[model samples]
Target: MAGPYWFARNIRAGYVGRDRYGKGVMPIAWQGRAVIAGFVAAMIGGGATMFLLFFYAHQMALGVVIYVILVIGGAGTFIWAVATRSDPDKSLAVYLAERQRARSTGR
Candidate 1:
């Protein structure tokens, strides 16, 4: 048997775009925004749950473990989405270089 796949098949390139400074990606479409929203929701919900577990339930060790897992899993999922959905041909470095050249030439 094969392991479960986590990526969405309908995610297309360009949904995420490279940052202006070539550091990272940003959402360029609704799909990308949805991914970001999901990540945010996961973090917020997990934090609240962890708080309750630590204080109300009196499970400090378990709460810490759960919170760590949530952070790792959420970050991994976000990275996977961005990696698989971003435009492959777009390079922010190339764009910035071209812009610099144009400025130097006064064009």
Candidate 2:
């Protein structure tokens, strides 16, 4: 739902197509791919945590352990993603250039 909206918004915002020079200079595909991948990964992670919590309903201590592990793992991933995130605009520019070159060369 949100993904479609964003894809459309990016396309409308001149982030997915070419300009007067007939050159493709948008990193729309990269952005969309990243967004979808992140969304799916998050959903899976959350679902696994929920399943674990419910599966060990009788064992409260075990449930607590599962929740703790989930929290720690989620926190670690979040921190790593933030710590390693590249400059968005610069990365977009580079992606767009590479895409354009690939298109021109028919690759």
Candidate 3:
């Protein structure tokens, strides 16, 4: 079965090939993992928030507190996604150039 395409291809080629300085970190994979992790965390957080709202339904102040917490959590998730930006095409270009140079030098 064909899988989702990343960076216009799904080949198992390691761009940057794990440099010592870790500068070659592939942002595509990291971004995907971060999104998945964030979604899961959000789901759990929403559930917990709902539970708290239900538990404290008798108190109007508690409900308001829960609403604020949920709103803040949701905003935090959005901000986190924005903060963890990724540009895989540039990384792929670097990888290709390095490979070409290595092959040309017979390394």
- Which sections of candidate 3 miss by over 4 Å? 1-27, 55-57, 88-107
Q: Mind giving the per-residue lDDT tens digits that candidate 3 earns over 5-103? A: 122222244444433223323324445556546656766776676677677665556666766676667657645553444333344455566658878
User: Global CA lDDT of candidate 2, please?
Assistant: 0.47
Q: Could you say which candidate leads in TM-score?
A: 1
Extract clashing residue pairs from model 2. none
Please write out the lDDT profile of model 2 over residues 24-63, one tens digit for every residue: 2222444545644564576567667667766766555665
Please give the RMSD of candidate 1 to the true structure: 11.8
Clashes of 1: 0
Model 2 ranges with Cα > 4 A deviation: 1-57, 88-94
TM-score of each: 0.60, 0.39, 0.35
Clashes of each: 0, 0, 0
| lDDT-sorted candidate list, best first | 1, 3, 2
Collision pairs in model 1: none
Q: Order of candidates by TM-score, top first?
A: 1, 2, 3
**lDDT of every model, 2 decimals:** 0.63, 0.47, 0.51
Query: Among these predicted structures, which one has the highest lDDT?
Result: 1
